[model samples]
Target: MKRQFKKHFSHNSELKCFFYRLHFHYDFYKKWGSTTPISLSFWVFTFHVRENICNLTLKGSVTVKIISVTRIIDDMGRIVLPSNARKALNLEEDYLIMRIDNKKHHIKFSSSGRGKEVPIDESGRIPISPDYMNKLGWETGTEIGLFMQGEEGVLQGNAPSCVICGSNQALLLVKKTHVCEDCIHTGTEASAEKWSAVLNDLFQEYKQYCEAAVTFTNTEDVHKARTKGRRLRTLIQFIGIKKEHPLYKCLKEAHDILGKVREDDVFIDAFDKEAENNQYSELYRKFIQKAEEEREEHRNELKQKLPHIIDDEFSARWKTFSQDELKDCVYKLDIETALQKYEKEFSERVIKYQKIKDKKSDKGLDSLHSVRKKAKKLRYIYNFLDLVQSIDYSRKSRQYKKIQKDYGDIIDLRDWINETGSLGEDIQDDHDDVKKVRKQLNQRLKRLVKQVEL
Candidate 1:
């Protein structure tokens, strides 16, 4: 009977008969006699029947070497390899090499002379060490499909999940790990806390700078204080503080006062450098003395007002606002929406400036200055978002920074020309040197205007 069966049964027909017999617990001929089809676990029964039939027909001959098993990853991220599988594969080495197939969503383990060694314990358990687990982004309680192919064991993760929260919904692959949007929101909350810390630190530094400016006679101190004040004000606006807020008003007043002193210092420095040339020596000296006197007057005004601007009451208000109001605002802020709003504002400003530039009117210098200020604010906001939200806007930030610098140079040249004109009337020598410098500045300004794009 066995010989007749082996001789007459086609390979596929014999397998079908074998499957029916296994599913119905009947002899192959009897099961084949019935026409009813029986369904079973396809993969499990197919592989099992193939292995059994091969062993029976071939008398323990090897046709195909394979094994399949399902294993649960324990808390320690360890899985037991059955003795039969290990023996069949001749997996006697203490270590195996692991390879990941991200495309197929499976991992393969084999014996190798190279690569990192994954250890198998004495009880036939393979412990996926911490490093390997992290590399695979697998966590405890993950089910893995284990199967053998030739001398290699393959593992497949059962389902994708959020690495942070184990959520299966809305999973996003990030650097070989899955993340869900809910966890991303939680991350944003954590970032808000970090931003609060950063804000507090900045406020403290600004106070320190204000103190240094008032206590010291150095012009650099005033410059540092004003810069810090501008940064704080930018942050304040980003946090959605109204301009009518006392905090904004206070900072703006102080910033404006310091700007006067800083401007005089800049003028004096320019004059000193120009005075090195004997042609403008007397005129430069006179202007330098006048700038020094004005700077002292502004400095005294700043010293009187600085202590009042960021006093204890203001500090208390800031702490209250940052902890209570600012925290909530920042946490609830949709970063995408904020970015869009700023971008829209910037686009509008660019359009306005472009129209003004096209008209070639001096009346638009104020509009040009507005565009420059808007670009600077946008650049600062981009940097702020990067630090607080981990968004990569560095390219946009760099772009806007260049815009700010270019416009700033034009404004500075314009101011210098105006100042030179004012001072040149007092110099009697036909004003040739002044005209030459002014002409050079005007030419450079025109070139810069031409190079600038909307």
Candidate 2:
């Protein structure tokens, strides 16, 4: 494969560029399945049909190889791009990529939406975003006709659209398209003020959740408060806020503190219901009481978070996020475009979950739990795009929800059993209780797998 790859560049002057990166890990890359790195286009060039490797420059538009190169991060977290590759790729001394603002464009392509700003170095070569190009089905050796737009080196609103998506928002035009940041980049960027207001309100509510920690009357409020705390934490992360700052740590600690309370509450609810009308209600009464006691003990643990959550410093930091201005509202992604970009992710997750379904072992169950959480994220993006209204959405939703519910039940029962052991109150015949629940869980999971038909 090295000889094969080397031969392609053997006669080309750019052989030095190709050999430096690929030779470093030739065997590893050959084993790659669906997962590709940042530089998808160049590898894609290598993957293209030889017969289709031709480019027709529109006027002066020159297409070029936008190969992806992954740099290893040292222990100190620094990446060094080699000089030969940089020169060959026309990279700048200090590369800067300011995110593209979709709101600035008067006429926006609502279909494709927004994406990341293409990084332009001090040197003039623009790194092509392969997302749309791949969508356009271009090969690696495709020639990109390079052209300058506007006068005085100031690219005007007439900046070339992405070579792929045709979005004129930022400088993503490798002569035309912006580099793809993943399927999530495109979508809404309506008004910065509204985003700020919404974030402010959410942050305020998060603070309220912390304030009401002691007053929460039931598991529902506790669940919602925990969910809100997590959502607030993720909102800033999605917006690329100052991540390492104390504010992120506060949000993380707040959610983590609530996480225990929520987990215990879920176990209590699951067990209490199972025991409610059972013939052995009398026998299970003590177990229910034990569960409730455990939940309360964890709830009291929230007191530890009060000082940090209630402090003005923490409140002020969150308020700063609310003040951020996002001109565009990135709420919708192009469904077809997104599917093309994320199909590999969507496929591999399903495959992974399938491989773990029958393994009732502890480690397997832990992995299954992680997969369910990830499935929820996939569902979120699909629904956010309103892909739910599509023809097959209902079936797809059904298959995953069934799988998630089964795993949820198994996890709940497992946690309940674990919690029983830790509650310090001896429940007689605990083995019988766990065995009964495990048998039922196994039966339900089998049925769910059949229904999913995967």
Candidate 3:
């Protein structure tokens, strides 16, 4: 049997006999999205009104006391506000503002009448939209001609010099849009003349990922790895290479390395938990021993061929850029020079597998597999070209779409695998479904790799 209740929730103000209780917490505002239309306007008014009253009474001897109130919700979830608070706060029945910070886990109430109206240009930069600016008959290069003060104090809405760069000129109306010349000029030019910006941005992003990855390794930190992944994607996006390009193909390999490391870490953790819980801990121990041994075997193979890997590809990149050319960038200048030296070591993993792609030696093949896995860290850096150059948040972009398709499900499965490892082998029966899901995920991975390969 299915039952559904149709509850009505409208942006309505009803005349109430009691005052609603409100709480304020700063931490909520410090964090993520608490800025819904219902939330934003209410908070803005609540903050301003509180500040307004405080300022207005500051000069005088009068100390205004705003009463704290609470509404008690019964077991049935019905809230009754205290009658006294309603009368004290001048409660009138009109559509008023209610602020909710679900993130901070608090709620507040305010009357819309508390907000003072300030003049704004229709375009909305002066807190008015561009259409409104046109409606208001604002001309291009409008002078600093407006000012306003609420009970709190003065809040002049006048446009100032550009914020990004120090230019005394105000934003002008150009092509029915208000934008400063500095802001316009600061944007990346699409022309061939400014292509160096793209190249510089690519190298800088690559440096950032390398630094972050190194930091992750040193700290054994999950957060640093996540940051490294994000920056690596950004760098890959900036390079904007086709999937078929040799550089991008190499990047795909780098992606697999991080993916494998993350996957293996999760699997091992789960294996460790099973060992701890089961009476037959030997099985768990054996599983971990096998996994570790496999990892070591892979590592050894990479180490053996690493010298050649470094020498082959990295030397080419180094020679393409002079010592001075590499040294001048901010990312290059900030990170230790050893990161550059280490690239030679890591590239060996990437290049060695490519060299022996057809080798019949099973040991060589298996060893090469792990090296290829580690190579993904490099691809993660390389793939950022698409992210930084082409991805646009305002519109549907191909890079974002591909991420939703390629990485989204894999990340979920990876997290699940990590958590399952914590439960140990004693709970293996409980994780039959998880194991099935992982099998499905492996199939997905095969498809994703094939699509990129094609």
Best-performing candidate as measured by lDDT: 1
Quote each prediction's TM-score.
0.56, 0.50, 0.29
lDDT of 2 by residue, 304-337 (tens): 6655665798867655544432332123212344
Q: Mind sharing the TM-score for model 1? A: 0.56
Segments of candidate 2 deviating more than 4 angstroms: 1-190, 241-245, 324-346, 379-407, 420-425, 428-454
Please list the C-alpha lDDT of all candidates, in the order they appear: 0.67, 0.46, 0.36
Give me the runs in candidate 1 sitting further than 4 Å from their true place.
1-189, 357-361, 420-444
Q: Any runs in candidate 3 off by more than 4 Å, and if so which?
A: 1-175, 178-186, 189-231, 302-454
Residues 1-454, model 1: lDDT tens digits: 3443333333345444654443222242243324424222222132322223222323433334345566888988899887766776676678678766667756777776444577888888887767657766778887776766466667776545544445655444332334455654444444455578778888898888888888766768888888888888998887678899988998999899888888877788876887897565776686677567767898889889879887998899898887777756665454555668888888887788777734224656667877888888888878765554323567888988998987887776667677778766765774787687667767877777777667
Tell me, by TM-score, which candidate is best.
Answer: 1
Better of 1 and 3 by lDDT: 1
What lDDT tens digits, residue by residue, belong to model 3 across residues 1-454? 0011011111112101001222323343333125423232233223222222222333342233222222222333223333333333353442223333344333333434343233222221213224433443433443322211111111112423322232434343221222244333322111111223444454455434433433334323332333443443434332333455443444445444444444545556766776687654555565566566555554444334333322347435433432323222221211123223434655675466456543324443344444433344334433422232221222223333443445443344444444435433444453555455445545654454334210
Q: List the residue pairs that clash in candidate 1.
A: none
